[model samples]
Target: MKIRASRISDSILIAVSGEEPDPAHQNISRSRRLLKLIAAFFSLFKLLLTRYRRPEFGSLRRDVWCLDEREYFESFQQKDPDDSARGQGGASQQEQRSQRGKGKGKQTARLEPIGDLGYSGSTFFTTPNGKYLIKSLPRRFEYKFFTRDLLDPYVNHMRAHPHSLLVRITDVVHAPHPTLGGLLGVAPTHHIIMENLLYGRDAEGGRFSNKWETYDLKPNDYFFPERDIADGRLAPKSVKDKLVDEFHDHVRVSAANKRELLRLLEADTQLLADHNAIDYSLFLVRYPGPRASTDDGADDAVPDNVPFVDSDASPWRTGLVDADGKWTYRVVVLDFFWARHTFRAWALTSLVKSFNKVAHKGPMSITANPADYRQRFLKMIQDIVVEV
Candidate 1:
């Protein structure tokens, strides 16, 4: 007998023995079974290769891309028993083990709920070390309508560019609900751990009271004063003029800071635009205060009675804190949920409006080098839009 082999398809081969069996007498059913067996074996081989391709990245294996045993079996239900039996049992078992391992990984890092932080059904918690902010799905709901994976890529982007205007996403973990007070029927939650800014207290502490007297504020300046008229010592209009004039000088210094800030914003905007992830709703929180000097040491606290101003004379400082109440003047960027390609215009426009409301006063003009400030901001936005 002579044996000859020939390629049938990319994944199939046929081997024939002897010169050729009589076509009329050929065992057609047997040949068909043999062909089916070859195809099934090839399929199983491909499945194994895909399953073990990135075993270290367990999430990839358990994700929807990989098939479960039941799904695989159901897909090939019409296959012959002998062909399906060849490696089905062993392959199925291995797949189950791979998925089991992934599930175990998720359960071990379960996130504990710390109650509502703000947005509906969005809860906050601290990691085991209590150093990071963990945002997770509500414990009371099963179906999450929001995109959890959207945050993963944003976190990765921030980690690569830590000093960018964007907030930093520290880590991501898979977690399960606490047994008690847990939301019913909710699946294992994916918790995003971020650098928590809430731990730090503003140097001025709380919103500035609008009723406080602004001896230096003009009739048109934006100044928050205490509402209660306990003391009739409102300064005379002449004194207010002197204060407003001096305040305008401080505004000059503030314009310089704003110029620097615009530069930072421009750079960040370009980077985000390049990535094609721009969302106009994205707003950077401005921490208005004098930049802290390292020489000032760590124990510096804002004096309670200092007059509010945009310059270093003002006590408001932005800082970060650990769970133990320790704070530092480190700037952290956060909240990338609204990042998208079209968001730059809205974000920049919002910032401009805010500056106008809080910092800009009288005649809609920049006091300290009007031409320079307007030119810088316009250039910044132009650069951002072009890059995007």
Candidate 2:
């Protein structure tokens, strides 16, 4: 596939196509000319992008940052976690500091994968401090369009309500070379840097250890239950354990808080539905309330760090706790870039490899029409936000 992007006034124009893959064809003829133009184009893009935070949506700014192909290390940052974690009886001294002390200079810290590996067939990794998430974009996704559609509404929501539940997207990245190189059945990769819903509050030095129970939730008949889960097989055990945890079946909050949560959810989903998007799940995380004890779920042992979560991630702070000791939920709809396609579009595009299941049912299923998708999406969200 051939991919290229250029800034168009306030928005960027991204064009990706699976025209021809043969290196022989690409190296010689018009493809070579296109490469030369691209090199010149992006070089110009870097220089011009300095003032181009145009129509900036909070941190949802535009840039073309590259991942170094050379020296760099992943250091899951941990500062003075030694004595506290030891006293708390969390992970072993060795295990907690495993990824640290092995880096140098700018390699001091990097994003690390937590929870489930290869969740939903996409590589899910979070920043060392758990403030940002880096995930693989779908082959069907048009990043420029996706960014524009979601970012506009997201910025507006943040501006109006301040701490909204919408998952804030700060930046979208286009890594030219394959980050997950030679992975079978995987298409060209474009990563999205999203504000992690777990800890929107950016803490000092980015060292966080808040024990949170997380779930990617959807209503019944949503097809969210994978065959692996159905066949009594669930993955990345860390996440699966919490997925089956009884305490998290439903979030407990006051009626007033429930109403507020539902209202925010509806607004976020409406934005997606209006854009003809579906197959998104509301990611729910439960933090410890004042009266609630924080535990990392290791029986007979106290949990790790109580993260003073990142405060810079403004939108996610809307998960307000009530006067009662019941848990509050930090919820955001995720994976809305999976678009429904027209008959002609589907039939024509079917030739390429598909990451998504074409036929689906219920709320999790996608629709070809925007209006149809909107109704189904709203209905499911309304069903989810009940008991208010």
Candidate 3:
């Protein structure tokens, strides 16, 4: 899934590509506009008259709150709402069909559920285009902390530092469904939309043609109930499978890349540490292949939105290659919602300490302090990312 660079002239033409005016169609369009105006007037009148009532759980509006509208819109190179509306309204049936035919390779983004992936009980989903991931915030405190406390800081941080390794969260969709809330104590209605790190890996004959390996890594030099506690050890393989870390080897990169990687990680984790957040993981995806040439005739690049072709250091979407050219690595910091101040975190801290003491082991990663966790996280990455 090579992304072709879009041209300015092509964009300009497409922006103003509405059909020429016809006398017969003019009347229909005028009537439609008049009808729409009438409808809007009535809707406003109805709103003014209707009593202010709290929205019901199931019937509540599914609000799509875009965290960074401009960033994502430009990054995706999506059509403007007005342009889409115009295209739909002005196009003839034949023209509409023709437009659809032209959109052969592109896919309409849709939510597809990806059943249980990790220790975190949150539900997961991916967009049909494989560009975006939707992860549910099953815990109330987690979602509340994100929206109430950390949201502003996170947005500000991302805007201030574009090269931060933190996963890009573009939107938060709050769909209050009675069924989910009523069934589970923790309402899984709030979902976070993020960029998928392993994007384009599954695409046919693209830059990511090589088989990609992924690892959700964290500090393992601590007491883990799955490996330490008796009950956890006795648990089924399925349960233990979720808690395992598959990657154990070091990832070697150029000294410059390593320094940049650590610098970004340090800055990103500092924000999380300040906010008393913990239990974050570095989601790493790597493939054994040479970096794709920019002049590969495809010109598969989104101008200014994606990584710079000239610089070989930080490739945001394309990823960076190791010094040996044995691997192309993409990394994003993930799952930074678990704050120390949260009730669950506090309780778990106590439980973890008691268990650790009994087992005579070190501090558990999930139960460690924000600052301590940040240190461990950085060290974990430093230990693994060998400077070549």
Candidate 4:
């Protein structure tokens, strides 16, 4: 398999073939190139298809700054009901003027804008205090394209369920413009502000300490370990226990942590059981280390066996300043557009790898004691599966 970088998008197009054709053979060379081109085009097409297949709440543009942080905050303040200048209700002229001044005062502590904070459509911004993360949607897309009535019910279910890991929703803000291009036809721009992951890192961060190293894994590389365990070639007990201990440690150290992840997994299963969503990918992220000073240009090394402090449940609950200033958990729901297919299993598998890497130094050690932890984790996962 060969990967080619695309000039148009951040995604890389892949070309996988059975064997490399002989360069000396003109016909074989031409055929291989053609095949490669076709593969590349198809891969890019598939990504676009995936983007359009779901409702786009924001731009798919690779560049950040599509949504400016200060503008987003200004918009939110303008629309907030509590604001005196809020246009929604009838406020006296004096009240509106007073509120405007107060709102301006509140804006005094604004931080610099964050540009490339997300993996996909949205960009994340934090306040100076690091208590809230603003996920700004694009200003061009239709709101209905991404939102559904199911969201409220789904969120409520997660809140009510003891085992759900879903993040809490605090407030929803409508932007002045649609975040998606050309899709906006009088649809207001919008953003969802909710509980940020308070006490944990993203799934990907947990898997590998180094960013470049994690991307080296082929598709098959991710699945082979589980296959070995299933076939009895790998010890299941050992893996399970290690996973359990790691999860326990992650929760114990994190603040405002709850049994939410387990519950969210269970809720996902139920959603799948009822044919409510589609399977989608999810990942976790961690801060590499303290910011580099002006005098030092070197990347901060993530310490080994360092106990992380999870400050909040999600980034939305915290702010941009909080993310940069402190350690926190931000559980992002990547596949909200296709809620009909739940990717609980894949997520769990990924989580297993992630937690083990961060908690146990590498792949989880499936020793006798580790096996017990493994069983507990498995049980938690199984209970969710059964619920689904």
Candidate 5:
């Protein structure tokens, strides 16, 4: 991973707001503006500098920005109806304050692990203010495939279809180093910054909130070792927990809303299949609706990245309220990194075939062909989303 300095400089330039300064203040503002700019530059530089100060390693500090990501997120935020509600009150105010704090003199915030500790090997960290998630790309092939084959197309698709349910990847940071630690998977050099869809669900800054439940859904028709190995007797609790599906109830929405949701999913999955992507899951979240409020402190803040429509009848547009108004749903397709052509996928497919021959079971989710997987995935979701 070669860290490009020019790209970082360009990113800093792009991050600066494009709004013109007021004409009246321009003459008097130049000196103050220059001083402020210099201070901000140093502040950013200090933040980017790694804390590690090993003399032998020569002050390990490498920060490379994925320039295109900045523009992509800028467009995404502008297009996001939820984000547009910032400063107007409701849940957006918390996120607004979080962003405003980041723009101040210097940032002291750091990334911390979310409570769940995801089943995936990669580490998941959330920003201090819970606005964004930082996910490590420990696997070389997955990250390489994303950057080489899918990045540009994904960005273009999101730009064209801003309301698409695909997860918003805000930034990609590459911190290259000459150490063997990164090569051994001890320290991941590549990471992606994504918008936290479940932000503000939990108590934050003394603000209370209603409970929000989340589910990571995927097709479970095939034999799962966690569930099939003598009812998970042979698997560790952690493994069993990760593979088991706990979401038994259907996504109770009206028939019309279901159709719209499926339509969006069809388009999203088609893009993944077109690129040979597989093993993606629907990350669904739901909370009590207005009538079924569980907490008195519950506010009107919506997921920052999810599109909120103004029409009351439109589930997605109306912030995903259910047909009966019992729950509000937030859904996005995630983990579309594994590809059919990848060596890992091929190995998994081979292993599944060998196991299926002995146990008479179907292929695991990861082993399915892109087209086949898309069909099964859609059908599974279709079964889950039923009329209210």
Candidate 6:
């Protein structure tokens, strides 16, 4: 299979050139807007939810809690709330997304849109400081993901496979059936907070980001980055070659690292399949090389671009560095365990897939059995990982 790496270019000339008018664009935009509204709405709602949802202890998975205003958002230096954002110390109707933490003790969560996100809603954002991701999702999906099928077992699963590539859900601010309703329905809206995978968001994400290279990997079609093929396009064939060439110039890991990555992928995906869930993607990132030594923040990070090489520098290939160096990853196996296929849902998805329409991206990701999911995932990797 030909792996054609795609990129996010503002030049939609690529995506729009031959495409027919898409009604989905409205949905895509509205969904994105709803997503943004949720983020903003929650910034205001946080004032209330925190009162009830503030941090809980004894857990890192599915932990919920509020940033105590006394400790997190309060400060003598805080500006008067805007006229519209009066509640919960929110900016009145006229104020900005996050209150500026400008005073001597003012370290309130300064929020802003890093960019829009999602398949339908482009509604994902991160803190300016590059620490966390905050966004909302449909109530039903959120509920299912954190309960019996996903959240609890995830803890034991991660424990059993310590190196699994699951990004832990750190905290959440859940609204019980908001009066305003979900973007499309009456379902609740959940604000998910987690570690910023890949990189943190600053004000400039729409234009740029801290990420240097990111491959959002899924199972089929072409080892991801499929531009022209995945979506109808007639772009150049050299796209993959250019990207691989670029990857090798900056990153090269050893055999052990490759195996470790594959191991993690298999374990994590199998876990997803075990739960009768699928439709997730693997995000592999290559961090930027450190700035010049003379720069002031040089000491704070891994001095840019230097791949971490362990004792056996085995030349890890595939996705960033090998086992030796700084593990070239900001992995988050995303979009999983939403519907518990229970016995019924899984059976339906499996049965429908059996009729053999185009593959639902990857079937195991949907409802295929765990063993089958794991085997297929690993087999695909074997086919692609060239003697790394």
RMSD of each: 23.0, 12.2, 12.4, 19.2, 11.4, 14.4
Specify the highest-lDDT model's number: 5
Per-residue lDDT for 1-388 in model 2, tens only? 1111112110111111011145766557787777755553444222111111223532332211121111001112322344232122223334333422243112222345442332345555565445457665545344544665655665666666544566655545453432222133233244565656654333333233244566665433433334334453654555544332223344445566667666766676676667666656667666555445433233422122334233433223445453554454566667666655534335533532242354432333433345555455556555544452
lDDT of 6: 0.42
Clashes (N, CA, C under 3 Å) per candidate: 19, 6, 0, 69, 2, 37
* Candidate 1 lDDT by residue in tens digits, 1-388: 0110001110010100011235786656987967754554443111101111122222321331232424222221122234321212222323433443566411112223465542334556542222235564333221121133344443344344434444433333332213211223222233444443432222244343221212111122223121112221565444333222222211122334445445555555454444333222222122223333243333453322332111111111233221222212233223333322223434644655676576552222112222332344335333322210
Error (Å) of candidate 6 at residue 381 is 4.0
Q: How many residue pairs clash in model 1?
A: 19
Q: Each model's C-alpha lDDT?
A: 0.31, 0.44, 0.58, 0.32, 0.59, 0.42
* TM-score of each model, in listed order: 0.31, 0.54, 0.65, 0.35, 0.68, 0.53
Please report the candidate that would top TM-score against the real structure.
5
lDDT of 4 by residue, 1-388 (tens): 0111111111100010011235666555777867754553433211211121111212111111133223222322223334322112233333433554566412212322344332234545443223345454443222342354345455445445523333333334442222232143212134444333422222223442332111110112122343445464565654433221122212122222334444454455454334343322223333433332222334343332333222222322331212233332333343343332224334544666676675443332221122332234335333322111
How far is 75's C-alpha from truth in model 4 (Å)?
16
Model 4 segments more than 4 A misplaced: 1-99, 102-106, 117-119, 139-146, 176-188, 198-264, 272-275, 279-335, 339-388
The runs of at least 3 residues in candidate 6 whose Cα sits more than 4 Å from the true structure, single-residue gaps closed, are 1-58, 61-108, 120-122, 160-162, 182-188, 200-211, 222-252, 288-328, 340-370, 383-388
lDDT of 3 by residue, 11-31 (tens): 111222222345776566777
By TM-score, the better pick of 4 and 5 is: 5
Candidate order, lDDT descending: 5, 3, 2, 6, 4, 1
The reply for model 2, stretches above 4 Å from the true place, is 1-106, 115-120, 138-145, 148-161, 176-188, 200-211, 222-248, 293-319, 342-364, 368-388
Error at 300, model 6, angstroms: 18
As for TM-score, the candidate ahead, 2 or 3, is: 3
Q: What is candidate 1's CA lDDT for residue 35?
A: 77
Where is model 5 more than 4 Å wrong at Cα?
1-107, 176-178, 203-210, 294-318
Output the better candidate (2/4) by TM-score.
Answer: 2
